[model samples]
Target: MPQDDKISPRKPRRAWPVAMAVVAVVAVVAGAVTWRGQADDGAPSPDHPRNRGTELVIAVGDVAGGEFDPLKGWGSRPAQIRLIHSSLLTVDKNIDFVGDLASDYSVSDDALTWSFTLRDNARWSNGEPVTAQDVIFTYDTLKKDGTRFDLTFLDRMEARDDSRVDFHLKEPRSTFVSQLSDIPILPAKHYGTDYSANPIGSGPYVVADYQVGQQLILEANPHWYGQRPQFTKLTFLVLGEDAALAAARAGTVDIAYAPPAFAGQRIDGMTLQSFETVDSRALTLPTLPAGGKGKIRTNDVSVGNDVTADPAIRKALNIGLDRDQIAQIVLQGHGRPAYSLVDGLPWFNDQVVFEDGRTEDAKRVLADAGWSDSDGDGTVEKDGRKAEFTLLYPSDDQLRSDLALAVAEQARALGITITTKGSTWDGIYLDGKANAVTWGGGRHHPHQIYEMYSSKVIDSGYNNMPQYTNTTVDGYLDQALSATTQDKANEFWKQAQWDGQTGFAGENGDTPIIWLLRLDHLYFVRDGLNLGDQPIQGHGHEWALFNTLVQWHWTS
Candidate 1:
């Protein structure tokens, strides 16, 4: 905490598990009982010893891969975005929408149009009042020229005046407000076609300097309409663990998002803060054909093979995974068991169970599907072809790589052979190819379904890597996206999960995507920093919660 810098530390009161402190310790012990904690009373306490600071430095395990532009790829990483942005609306832990830039908002009768009333007094760093034109301009820019990252729900945008703006939808979207929460309103005057390089916005912090792949320095924006940030200057230094750890351990940086493997190791005069997470590391097994020979896309077999098309195969693979062991051994209990796609979202239904780790069930499913161990070899074979494929994960992400290898071992026991491949993210996900490995999710919402499997993203296939395609599931997705009421929308959401589980598109009891674990985003801050109110939903890692930076403060 530096007074001259006037940076107040804000403690983000994220939920903690009973096993938080034990994760790294257990990983080191190599033999410890896994402890579980209830989420009922796990909010951050004001009197806790760890929460305090001003001008805190956080160690993030991974730096954003690209520039901090929504049009580019790095826009989705929540840690990088906090340096310069704010969303229009905020989602609380309970999945309620709160206004940010807008004072209030309302949906039309048909739910096809949503209007937001802007805060007339809100002003940009340049001392210009924030108007509806900024909103319209942002939407228009992304709609016409934005990259895939910035184009959600931006089919049409209209501005009536400085105080009001409307979003015309292609369909009645129940989660339109949540979707809008991802868009930050950039200044209309300063941000135009050249905005990506010289970005200007009415957010909590303004970019002071940018060094690609090196660092980004920021300064507080004085003209913000809400509570101003305490820190006058903030620096985001890009460095690897060896450097980040040296910075933190040497007291060069006060905070850092260190790796889970390095979690428990302590630096003199510094405390190690830990929290439970819903962020699970799992892989996508592509079920579609390769080389454009089948349904989804035309590409090499590098992304996925036609093997995932079998539902029984999906179920068998899922049932065989010992997620508890992975959580304990691979993740050191830093993660949770995941059975559904929305590991940390609001709509995550806890009723479903997939954790028997039953190899017999896996064997039964495969046997019924005509796969068997014929050549007297331990591995299952189908018509002289042994079940074997390569599982690919980001070369830089060790957690995912470990998970892939662990799952592969389990599949091996079931007479299935899975190999692991580490590759560059661009080659794996971008470049219009699919991979058998990738993991990501946000606050549980209907858009998770749309974004993951929707035809709109088949080209990039950012999250939906399985090359999974089905008309029945697509119909249910369209229903949920167009529902007029939240209750109706909820029904569609449930049905979608059921449809996925039922294997209605292909096999009744088979599924393509088998969820492995759930995650609660965890962040560690310097002592005395006030994180302010955080939404339990959406993991507060999305654009919706970036505004919390404005209200964070440091106390003596």
Candidate 2:
């Protein structure tokens, strides 16, 4: 790492005090506004004109697992993990797979063998040369207890030499290329149980300092083989949305990740940077009926919803609610209507889109299915069962809470009572199987769609919560994974979503889940801080915002 011409790469003078345990935005803002003294090291504050393009400070959402372990789901998204680690492959700005550490890559004609030729110059920050042994060790270690990549397709992996590696699969899968980008190559010599705390990698940056729950400082890695980043020093602060916004206002942070709720606000020296994303929220209604067989997860936790089990009730909710209106009210026009989890992706079937916001259409569908307000109680019923169910959202997530509340309100017009409540993520996981839960997830690939709808992995680590079962859908999903080419696979993936006559879509279609909106990730960025041509974000994970950090530069 460079020692000269770089901002202080040691401690962050304005580091949020973990000992004080202060979380209030007003308190932090007050302190930032009141303390106008120069740093003890005499380094200009990040907001100073002299340091406009030399350094950067970013505020991000919570750190998963509070550690940077690649095996424990740290480098799963296009995030900071990319800064400290190298992979055989990586995604470009458009979320397209491209070679990273590997100088060249190719797949076998059988579509089961994948090969990568590593670049010779790649070296760890410690000056150790990266080797094929390290790549094999990464996969072997992940196979034991990995929480990020789905290794179902990977049968075996081997290294041909220091600059060569190959992966053999049990089956053909188009997502295998994307999965390669998720696993960060680990150093075999320094890897162990304690590697998470003290890490070394072959990426563009070195971890200079890290304060648990407070801040992280990174300096440019001098041994990096890739393009040099313009800025040499970077600091990341973990703060709640309120405190992050306050920091941006106080000129203590260069960029602050915010939700649409704060998109209307303005900062003194910052510009609102809104990037479109495939990240969306969907109300997953369990397809299984209560008191039925296979209702229990592997852990014995019961899962299923009686009301949502009725396809007609699910379809009614999907047709009645106006998604455009939800985007207007809940997201404040920062988002748009979404039909399926893979909307805007190549495999998405736009034919599933239908006319929404029609109360009469919803009522007619319900009535044809034998649900009506016979007693005039403003609630539809059929065979003594009322059309109502509880909806759950993460208590801390304001976007999801707003979405759930809006959906509940819209469903009222169709006499379908929806009870909305905010709960913890753990609570939602256990209880969500029996109730409709507003969940958020979207990536560039179709694996998530298969996992959520496939019956083969029901209740297997939150996959297929609906326990939806359709032989045709399952066959399509299976064929998607087995398709030899990406284009062929996309066709099958689309068929799984909607085959015209029967599928997972709403509007007389099997509606196991009702997707509402695709949101835009809004950020408060310092003026003249150009984020280059950033790719459209598919995952909601805040870390993905740093995907184009290498392309950032200053205009003035």
Candidate 2 lowest-lDDT run of ten: 1-10
* TM-scores for every candidate against the unseen true structure: 0.81, 0.90
Top candidate, metric lDDT: 2
Local accuracy of candidate 1 as per-residue lDDT tens digits, 1-556: 1123221122112223436423422221221121122232322222222223345444454443444456554445433454465567855545567787889899888887889998877887777888888888767766775454435554587778778998888778787765466666677778544555566666766666554444455677777677767766666655555456555544444455555555566665455554443444555666765444222233333444655655656777777777787666566656677776664354444445644688887799899988998887787777666677677777766566777778888888888888788888656654223346646555534566666665445545354566666666667777887798877877666666664554322223335566676644443345555656655424322233343566667756
The global C-alpha lDDT for each of the candidates, from Candidate 1 onward, is 0.59, 0.79
Q: Which candidate tops TM-score?
A: 2
Candidate 2 residues lying further than 4 Å off, grouped into runs, are: 1-19, 23-28, 31-53, 78-80, 291-300
Instruction: Report the lDDT tens digits of candidate 2 across residue range 1-556.
Output: 1233123333223444555547434444443332223223433233442247667878866653425676666765555478888888877876778889988999998899999999999998899999989998888887776345667668898888888989999989887766677678889998877665577889888888765555677789999998899989987766878788877776777888877788899777889988888888889998888865343334556667778998888888888889999999888988899888888689989888888888898899899999989999999999999999999998777788889889988899899999999998778877888889997778867788887888887756677877789989999999998888999999998888888787887466688889889898889988889988888876654676767778889886
lDDT of predicted model 2: 0.79
